[model samples]
Every structure is written in structure tokens, then in C-alpha cells.
Target chain A: MLGPGDDAAVLRAPDGRVVVTTDLLLEGRHFRRDWSSAYDIGRKAAAQNLADVAAMGADPTALVVGLGLPADLPAEWLDGLTDGFGDECALVGASVAGGDITRSEQIVLGVTALGDLGGRAPVTRSGARPGDVVAIAGRLGYAAAGLALLLAGRTGEAFQELTDAHRRPRPPYACGPGAAVLGATAMADVSDGLVQDLGHIAAAGGVRVEVDPDALEVPAELTAAAAELGEDPLRWVLTGGEDHALVASYPAGVRLPPEWRVIGRVTDGEGVQVTGRVEARGGWDHFRD
Target chain B: MLGPGDDAAVLRAPDGRVVVTTDLLLEGRHFRRDWSSAYDIGRKAAAQNLADVAAMGADPTALVVGLGLPADLPAEWLDGLTDGFGDECALVGASVAGGDITRSEQIVLGVTALGDLGGRAPVTRSGARPGDVVAIAGRLGYAAAGLALLLAGRTGEAFQELTDAHRRPRPPYACGPGAAVLGATAMADVSDGLVQDLGHIAAAGGVRVEVDPDALEVPAELTAAAAELGEDPLRWVLTGGEDHALVASYPAGVRLPPEWRVIGRVTDGEGVQVTGRVEARGGWDHFRD
Candidate 1:
């Protein structure tokens, strides 16, 4: 436990590079206060930021979180938020470094994550050359499924996992470093839906991405919930977002992490496709949604 | 010319390190729709975060801003906010790297600042040793003075300076890197007024800081405004926060930057003092008005 006090944290960029990312969460827009505790929001916030770090194929090292709350927001809520921040950081042995507090009508949290590449070249979204393999570590569409469950007025012990996923997403933080170590070609977190985010990588990497329908590992809980709502489980997996799962492209013949499953491949094309078909669909759009 | 399609941004950490900081701005608590335009609010939000980076002895390199606004928030207002963000980042050649947006009851901005140390160790608050000279860069009481003017409804052209300071503080971003290059021992942004922020450095460095009233640079404009408000101008300069000025310590005989002025000295003591007198006064506390 060396703590935060330096001019800047000294993270080990063993590959001589650090991966960085940031995300912001706002009350009402991102989550309903009735649905989650302040701790849940805090955990979700940190988890998303750390997931971005993971997407870069790096190990989470430190985080800086800034919070804005209305003057009347309860202090207990703040304490819960801090607890969540600290608790989630403890999961990865990282610490909150510094942040700023300001007044606002609602609560806003901004988190920045710093990560170490651990002697491996960063796995970037731009490196998914044609013929690369796409894989994901952690469950897909859980957050979106959870969001649907809440929207449908489902609760209690039966829907606990879905609710919990919505309130507090647990990203595969170590999987990022693992992918980097395993020489992942390109990587990103599934913040937006798998298809939408992959579109970004496809555009950036100048390669076409094709996801296979048969490869997706749809969790049984999500399948059951989808059935209850008369929704397609594959749609949840492909189109739902915010699972914060690490998705990466690996060179052919490279071994994937234990938890990761091969889902797609790269081609010398211009766009993203699923199951050999071009679908005019996306995960989440900030304004259009 | 290149954007964030890559696995990671190749930011220049000239000193082999980057100084990072973040701030979250919530609507109402930090700003009022009746008082500030979307442009002004956006600039102010970016200014506060940039000021934190400046305090770290680093050059502002990039900023990632996340916005949360209501569905009813006019598109033009969001445009104004984005323009303000772009304008401020342009001030120091920093670019907006990436960000997230969501729906909320009010506008929430989460900003992360990435800075280049330019080949110097970051000047932390704990490095101020005994006999170090304390210096300040940027305005002192202008923001407080502006706040006073706003509160009084005296919003004509006469109070433009004060109002402008309140809306968009001009932090000495370059001074952070300058201090690093000049071997500054300790540094912090004066967001909470000089006296209070000095107390932070003092506590961290285990050295008492003393300010000489005679050397204080209370802007004449503030003096005139304070007279109108029947308040003390020096009080605003000494205790008024949100100016985002950088205060640092240098070893004796070291030449200070032109933008920086010698204001006091560091000594072996328990706390911060002004003019050989101990004062219990400081800046705004979060829980209290």
C-alpha cells in the first residue's frame, strides 16, 4: 500500500507505454437513484473506466475520480460513493489518486484510468489487420439485459443478477493485461453494444469485422429473461451495450485467454458484419438513443 | 490529424511521465442556468480541470470531456458547450481526446486533463522544503470579486472583469511546465484561495508558509469592486477560491518565471500564516456555504 501523494503516480509501463482512458456517469441519465445505491453508481463508474484501460490491453494501476453533486445530496450518499470507489479499486489493488468536487443539479462522476502495458506492445483498435481473430473475455449483454429487466419492472431474487449487473458491472480487468501478454492485435471494451463498438475498431483498423452468431456465449440467465420478455437473446448479446467486456483481435494461431471465446474475424473490407450479413443496427447512440 | 481509432493515443509525455487530473461538474451545484450560458459554463468547467493540470507542473496536452444533459437541452446549447470546450482546449493546443455522454436532469461534465511534464519531475505539494520561496502565477481574487459582483445584480459593463473571471478563469497553464523546468519544490492550484491552498502545501510539506501582505497583488479592479460591495479586497485575494492560480515553492536565489511572483517563504512551522499573524480564515467548505 503505497498511497497517492506524488506529483503523478509512477505506474510501471513495462512495455514503455501506459494506456489511459476516461468515462463520465451522471444520475438520471446513466442510472435511476431508485434502482441503485450511491455505492452502486460509484462502482459502475470506476468499473467502466477501468474497462477502458482493459480494452487497451493494460493492467489497471490507478484511477482519478471527480464528483459533482447538488448541495442537498446526502452526505451518506457521498460516503457510499466513496466506499464503492475504494472497494472497486481494492478489487484490482489500485487506488484513487485525486479529484475535484463541484456543485451541480445532479451527481456527476468522471473517472480516469491509468494502466501498465507490462512489456507488451499495446493492443490497439487500429491493429486488427485482416485475418485477425476477435474474442471477448467476460459475459456480453448483461448490463443491457439488466437494464431491460429493470425497465420491465422485474425485481426480487429471481432478477438479482440482472439488477446487480446494471447497478455494478464487474469488468475483466486482468483480462486486459492477459490479452496484452498474449499479443492481442487490437482491443476495446464493449461499452457500447458489441456491434457498434466493433464498428469503431473496424473503421479505425481499416479492416472489416464479422461476428459469428453461433460463437456468442449467451448466459442462461439472460436467455431466460429474454424469453420472459419475448426478446431475442442474441439481440441482447449483439446489440445491448455496457457490459464492459474486453473484446480483442488476436493474430491467427494465438491462444486466447481461458475466459475469452472466439466470436469474429477480421477481413479486408470497409464495415462490420454479423453472421455474414450486414445489419443496420448499433448498440447505443448518445443523442439518438 | 489522427483521432482515437487507435488502441491508444500516442500522447507526448516528454518527461517520460504524464500528470493527470480530473473534475466533475454537476448542474445547479456548480452552475445556474439563470446565471451562465452554456458557453460560459462549458468554458468554466474546462478551466477548472485545466487549472488542476497546471498546478501539477505539467503542460496541458489533451482533455476528455463527458457531458450529460437533459433531452430538452437545446442542441444549440450543447453546441455552445462543445464550442466552449474546444475554445479552451485550443488555448494551450490541447485536443479533446474522447468522452461519453448520457441523459440527465441537468448538465454534467466530467473532464480529465492529460499533461506532459516536459522532462521534469512533477512538483508535488510535499516538496516544499524549509527556506523555499513561495511564488504565485495568475490572478488572485478576481474570481471571488466576480462572484460578489454577480450576487449583487450589478451586471453592467462596469463589472465585466469580475464577471468574466467568474465565467472563464485564465489559468497559467504554461506556468506548470515552467515550474517543473525551474525545479519548483512544491506546487498546487489556488482553487480554494491562496491561504487555504497554501495550508495544503504546508501540511503536506511539513513546513509552514508565510505570506507578506505588502507583496500581494490585489488587482485594482477588484479593489474598486470590493469598495462598491463594502467588502475587503485583500480578503477576497487571500481567501477567495476558484481563481485556479498556481502557487509553488523555489529554493532560495532561484529565478522565478516572469509570470510568477514571490509572495512568501516556507519555514519550519506548524501551519500557514499571513503577515506574521495566524488567521483561522480560509475558503469555502463543501458541506457548508
Candidate 2:
């Protein structure tokens, strides 16, 4: 409603800088109709991109979407998709601006998110100095646990929690701007699990991150679900992805955001470790094959 | 190479504003491998999106691409695609700052373009006034002519000109920023043919546009190709699309750029007409079903 009719939507950037990020979600690849509803897919897609903006320690401001749908798709499907996008944007006080529509064999949604930096330098992944405290602002293993439940042919009320997490990831969007205000040094979103994403910060900052298993604050439900499935809960927290939690490192004695909890520390080493020991594996790698 | 290893790329917007636009190109729907090489398809896709930035009367600054390719796709194909994108961006002094890559069953390219306002008011399509001189920059009907030549199975040097135009459109990119500085009232890019694209401006501005057929500078090859195919060259120029040319209207006596040619004038009426008569048809339309 706030001047979305213009050529480009106007957004306020108190720090005189904006962070922009985009992602493409292709049907049958990123999501499946059998697993994700039209509405759920829309919210998940928008959330993932918005989470990227938040990972930069910026407040989400606006989003522009380009959707390609097949000709046979029902009009109601598009309406539901738009409704989902609007619902998610409304949560952060952002608007869904103009978008282009074209015909394709499969549904493709391209989302671009705009963010405002609120009077703080962007907390990038390249500032994790040695001895910095690495903290997280949200869950780590829920989405992957949800995926496990779905794969196990589980349904009904007993599996609803896992299903909901996979359908719509509730990333810690507000904590990103809050962490930036609190003076976090380096940060990234936990989209590709804790270990893989932290490895990005580690490589960029030229330091190793030592995560402590005993210091983790994982939810009770994830632990129960992993126990039921005869799996390691720590593996779920370390390797499961798509939670989009904000993870950052701060200099010693720097005040941390209320939602953030210390889980690790930066050290003068080559890679990431768990409790002073390096893990042999990590999360998703797009190009390793 | 300038600070490209980050979660988000920074672009300078000296005027405190930017013109942003996006589009998606899906394989088998937007382009065919048999007709266009990977490089040509990439160039065409970039040209189409860059034309949108030009339509807003802004100079293109940077592009962020989201590429989805199948796992089996050769690395060389990606190389060709990136080379084409780099070539086009280099022409406008722009760069591909950052992008996301994901695996998919088919090729899908989601392109977002950012631009600088250059301290000039953006030329939108809602400001055309009666008596404004409507003009166009760049070639018209060439791409359509090329498609026609190929469809009719015209081969060898006889149809080479038409074939080339369809493969890659050479838009007048600088004319967009130029028209903005010259006080053009309203503007759009001619991607959906002259008459069809102009119809958008006419409908949006609530004015009629009268095109002079004799004033048109049709290419000699288009006329010759039309004769060989037994089609109307005038119709091709009026209805052929995908040239990505900039079209705008100026106040009377306003000096126009060298590349721009006066084609028509705005009138106090509805719809667009050719010379003194209204045409019954034009170019591509979605939802025709």
C-alpha cells in the first residue's frame, strides 16, 4: 500500500545503504506439489530470500517477484500463491511490489528482496576475528527433522510439527537487525546447516570456528524425534539445513542480542570443529559433484 | 573482481534511488537450443531485462543472475552462457556482481538488473500528453522478420540477415538515459513489437497514438524478405517484436537523440491507429485462451 504503484518501490535506509539478494525456486526441483501446498511453497520461497537479506544484518523492506506458470494452471493457484507471499511480507511490514509473468512448462518463482541497514555497518562473514564468540538466534535442525518425518511416511497430529517446519521455515528475521545493532562482527544465515554455513564464515574470516555440543540450545522436540528415528540429534543440529537462523560472531565482551545464544568461538585454525574436535562431514554442497 | 566474495554485492546509487527490474527465461518455452546457442540465448535474455531498466530511463549498473541448470549440463555450456552475459554487461560498463546457482531438470535463468537514475526524472508510461511527438530508437520488425525467414525454411546467405537478428537483438541502451535527460514525457521498450508495445503506453496514458506508415524507416532486407515470403513488410514493422528498442514521446519541438526517429504523435482518443485508421491486431498477448 505504501507507493507500490511507482516504477520501483521506495524503501528507507537509515545507514544510506541497502542490501539486495535474489533466489530462484523451480518447481519439482526445490519443492514438490505432493509435499508443499501452493500457499506453503509461496511462503517458503519468500522466507528463504528474506532470510538472506536478514543474514546481512539488514531489515527487510520490500520484495519483487517474477513468476512463470504453465498455461493450464488454475487462476486460484496463483491467487493462493500471492496470498501466501502477502501474508509473509506483512509479518515484516514489507510490501510485494510489481512482478513480471510469463508462461512456462513448470512454475518458476524469482524473488528479490530489498533491505535497509539501520545505522550499522553490515555484519558480513569476513570479520570473525580469533577469539570471537559465535552465537545463533534461531533453531538449526527443525526443517531437516521435518523432512525426515515426511520421508518416513509419517502423518497426522504426531508429525504435524515436523511437517509445519518443512512447509514454512520460521527464520529469525527480526534478530538480524537486532544483532547488527548489538555490534555482531560476522554473520550468516543457517540455510545450509550450522556446520556448512559456519564454514563459509570461517573460510572468509580466515579463522576456525569451534562449536560446542554441550553449549547447543536445540529444542526438546527435535531431540525426541531424532531419538525415535534412532538418529543422532547432534547430527541433525550440525548437518540439517533450511532453518535460516542468524549465526554470528562477536568480539569478546561485546553485548549480544537477547535472542542470540553463544554456541562456539573463533580460533586460529583452518576449519570448523565441534567441541575442540573437527567434524569429518558438513551440509549441502551445490558444486562438489 | 571488486569485492565480489560476499553474501551480497554493493552497488553505488549516487542519486539515492535505483531502478530495478527482473525477468525469467525458461528453457523450451522462451528459447530453443536448436534455434539459439547457449551464448545467444544468454545475450538475448540479458538484453531483454536491460531493456526494462532502459524503459525506466535509468542507466544499467549491475546484474544479479540466478541460474538453474541440470546436473548433467556440461561446464562448457555454463562458460558460454557466462561469457555472453559478461560481454553484454561489459558493453554498458556493468558487472555480474553475485548470483545463486541451483540444480534443476531444465535451464532457467532469473535475471535482475539494477540501475542508476543519473539525477534525471524517470520516464514512465503514464505521462504521455496529447500532441506529444512519439518516436522510436533502434530497429523495428527485424526479429519478427528473422523468425519468419527461419519458419519458411529460407537458407544460406539469402536469409542470413533475418536469421541473425532473431538470434540477438541490439537494443539502443544509451538512448534510455539519453531520453530521460532530454525531457521525454513517457517511455517504454519495444519488445512486443511497435504497435503492441505502443498500445501499452497508449492504454496506460489514456491517449491514442497515430503512426504514419510512410514515415517508417523499414529496413530494405525486411521488405525483400517479406516479398519472398508473401507477407506485408509494413505489418511486420508494425507488429513484429523482440527488438528491445526504446520508444518515447516528447513535447513538440524538443530536440530528439540522433538514433531516435519520429514515428507518431499522441491524440485525444483511445487505442492506437496506423496513419488514419485503427489496426485490428498487433503482437503477443497472454491469456488469449
Candidate 3:
């Protein structure tokens, strides 16, 4: 309930527990000033951390930001960044509770997000069982495709959707607690490449996850962009990152909400397996040959 | 309490709320690798933010770090930093809850600390009354003097203690809640310059703060160092920052713990005032001619 201007802000943790997560975004590594506005970077930073809170099956509460800025940077950029953070928090009923700023060589963002479990057990990454169905909510591969498009000098009106995806991701925040309430066994945020992230869940839970590509409809936009760029749309769907999508393993018999798509299954083994998309010959295991 | 390796950490907030604060430390502005070791930087970063939590009348529970490191940074430095964080947390029964690492041009540390209030009302800086007695717990002016010594290229063995104070500050974490229990009307961490931070408490509380000069004992080391450097020791005591000392205002009749020293009083006016010392002739206020 407490806000900024104090030494620290106090957030109500009604369930007697607080869920906390943090993420760092560097200027050149995570975002580029020419490609994304400060507002976009702020939104993306908040989204990724907030999505992590959701992945824990908690309701997002507040975010505290630690920002590093160069002295020559414009003040309007900071205003835009603040507005972006506030708008993103508004989307999920959360607020920017506190922040600290310092001078740096380039823009650096450290966002810490907190949440409350609301009496529900947190969904961890190591709880998947052999018979569970792997499901995901929110867009996948969009941000990666957007990044690729921006890198290719294709930031025209036709590519705006993909570029916007890279600049500001719209994470499905509510689906995290929703999945938890529905008894999701294991969960994670798809920030890293999907296959790499799924591998984490598999390794932690001691179970193999097999993806069913048939369940993922390659979007028309993705297909058109891939065709023009000589890339594989399905590959992006399988291995891209930064979508901040929620991936969870639910008991096979449990009914999923409308927003969730059953894209895979948990099995008695280790490592990620993509059905109907064998790519053992590729330099990288998950990429197309 | 849940640890790292999950989507987010779960920390029990027994009082139904969590006190949270964040701070950003950049390489050139906040610390220099040549002057402070990675371990020192880590400990200093943690101490500053943890002290902020304690200043809110809470016990530190956990910390989440967001680190942006140069690719050329040594692995041993990272290890030392981690050890320092863990050791500092161990001192107060807190732990490292979660962390994120990213590539950056320079080292950037963003630390978010959480705390538990233990059912006590938070001792905010706006609660001081006209009759309150101002007291402080922890060192004053030591770090500032140390910094001056280092900047002057006098980091010899004789100045080790003073230099060390600048490298690593020891804040009295327990004094915050302890002050609250003893009826502290207003409290804040002396992070910014003492008079400047007191100005914050004064403005927020809408009462004038009259600092008693006789109450502040200029350390002998500071006096000796000031003589050698041709500086004023008392000025450092009155305005230096980064000691992270806990300064609070309590009812005049309340008995403070032994660690606390009465240093000032709340009076019927606005702005910060120094008793037994006036600087009306100085070009700028709060300093001697």
C-alpha cells in the first residue's frame, strides 16, 4: 500500500508470502535506442519481470526499478520510460512502487517485480509429471521475428507488427495465476529460446517434453515474412525467445482455459523433442537444416 | 522460503506486508574497480539497500540482484561478489533470493531488498512531532573522511581504517525496528548528507530540526586526518553521506538503546537548523566560512 518518496515502499502480501524476481536489460545487449523508444524498452523490461512473477503463479503486485542512465541522455526519454512503466503496470493492476537511478555509460535497467500467492501454492519449474499436458498462453516467436525484421532493415509499415513485438511484448499476465488456480504442475516464462527454456523445465522436472507442431498454427504473417526472408516460420515457432509467454504442464485430465493451447506433452525422459520437426542435421540442434 | 532456480522466489512476509527498496550502482559513478574489490562493492551495495529496508522499521528477509557485467570481467571477481553478498545476508539471517545477469559495457549492480515489519507500524520520516528528540545509530563522517583520503592519494597503512570505512560501511540494521519499538516518531537512513537527509525528515514532518553541534563528537581519526588535509572535521560530521546510520526522532521521554546518541531535536518551525552554530555569513548555507 505504501508508495515512493519513502526509504522503502511496503506492499501488502495478503497470503503471508511474497514472490520476487529480477531481470537486467543492457543498452546494446537487450535493446537498441535506434530500434526501440525508451517507452518501449521500459515496457519490455517490466513485462519480462512481471511475467516471471506470473509464472510463479502469483498475482503481480509491484515493481521496483534500478536504472542506469548516461548524463547526456534527454529528460523526455526518462519521462517516456516512466509513462511506459506505469502503463504496463496499469495493464495488470500493479504499480511502480520505488526506484533508484545512477549515471552510467549506457542505459541499463534492473527491474524487480513482486507478487502475492493469494493462498495458492506457487507453480515451480520442477513439478511437471510424466502424464501432464504442456500448454502455453500468449504469443510465441513474435518478438524474435520482430527482432529479425528490424535487423534486416525492414522496419517499414508492412513490418510494423513484428517490429512492435520486439520493442514491447504483451505478456499474458493473468494466465499465470489462472493456470495456478487450475492446478498447473509446472510453469515457466518463455524468455529464453523456447527449446532452451523448455529444456530447463525438462531437466528440473526430470521429464522429457515432446512438442506437437500440429497444435501450433504458423500465423499467416509469420509465413509471409518467412517466405520473403527465406526463413522457416515453424523454426521461429519452435526456438525463438523473448515472447514472455507462459508455459505450463497441467494434469492430462484437467481442462485448460480458452486462451491456453496444448502444444506439447510431458513424457518419461529428458531433453526437448519436437515431433514432426526433426532437425538433427542442423548446426544448432533446434534450428532448421 | 523459496530459493532461486524457480520462476520467482517465495519469501514469507509474516506481518502480511513486505518492505521493498532498490538501488543502482554503476561502475564509474558509484564505485571504481581500482579502488574497491568486487567483494567490497557487493557488500556496500547490499548494505546500503538493506539499511534502507531497516530504516522502514523492518528486518531484511531477502535480496534479488540484477547484475550487468562486462564480458572481460574475471570469473573470480563474480565469485567474490557472490560470496560477499551471501556473507552479508548471513549476518542478518537473510539470503540471496534470485538474480539476473546481462552483458554490459561496464559493471552495473541493481539490488532490491525486501524486509518484514513484524506487525510494527513502519516508522516513516513524516511522523516527527515538535517535542521529539533526534538520535542516531551507527557511524557518522567516517566514510566521507575516508573517501577524501583516498581521493588525495593517501591510502597508506596509517589510513587503512578510514579507507576501509569508505570501502565498506557497517550499518546498524537492528536499530530501525528497535527504534520503532521504543517509539520513534520519524526515521530515515542517513544516506545523503546528514543535514540534507534531515531536511527531508523536516520537510516531510513539517517541523524544524535543530541539530545540536555538541552532540556530534568529531572522531579523533577524523580530526587528525582533517588537520593533515587542511579540512574541517566537523563539516564532514554535519553533512557527509553514505554512513547508512539510522537517524530517528523519538518522544523526549523515551529511552534509546545504548547504540543511539541523542544529536538533535524537533522544533516549531521548518527547515534544518544547527544549534550553537550559525552560518548566516557563508555564501551558501550550512557551511562555515
Judged by lDDT relative to the true structure, which candidate is superior, 1 or 3? 3
Predicted chain B of candidate 1, TM-score versus the true chain B: 0.93
Q: Regarding DockQ, does 2 or 3 come out ahead? A: 3
**Model 3, position A32: C-alpha lDDT score:** 92
Task: List DockQ for all candidates.
Answer: 0.40, 0.45, 0.87
> In CAPRI terms, where does candidate 1 land?
acceptable
| Top-lDDT candidate index | 3
Cα lDDT tens digits, model 3, B1-289, are: 7898987899999999999999988888888899999899888989998999999999999999988888999999999899888888877788899898888778888899999999999989899999889999999988999999989999998878888989999999989889889989999999886787888898898888988889898989999989989999988887788889999999998877799999989988887877767422111254553
iRMS per model in Å: 3.0, 2.3, 0.8
Give me the runs in candidate 2 sitting further than 4 Å from their true place: A1-16, A276-289, B1-4, B276-289
| Error of model 1, residue B26, in angstroms | 2.8
lDDT of 2 by residue, B1-289 (tens): 2235566655666666766777888888777787888898878888887877887888887788889899999898899899888888877887787788989888989888877777777788878999999999988988899888877778559878778889888989999988988889989888877887778788878898888877888778988998999998877788788888888999989987589899889999866788654463333452011
DockQ of candidate 3, scored on C-alphas against the true complex (2 decimals):
0.87
Compose the digit string of candidate 3's lDDT tens values, residues A1-289.
Answer: 8889999999999999999999888888888999999898889889988999999999999999988888999999999999999889989899999998887778888899999999999999999999999999999888888888988888888878888998999899999999999999999999876777788888899999988888986888788778877888877777778889989999998998799999989999887878866522122354443
> lDDT by residue for model 2 over A144-208, one digit each (tens)?
98888888866567768877898899998898888788888899988888888888898888898
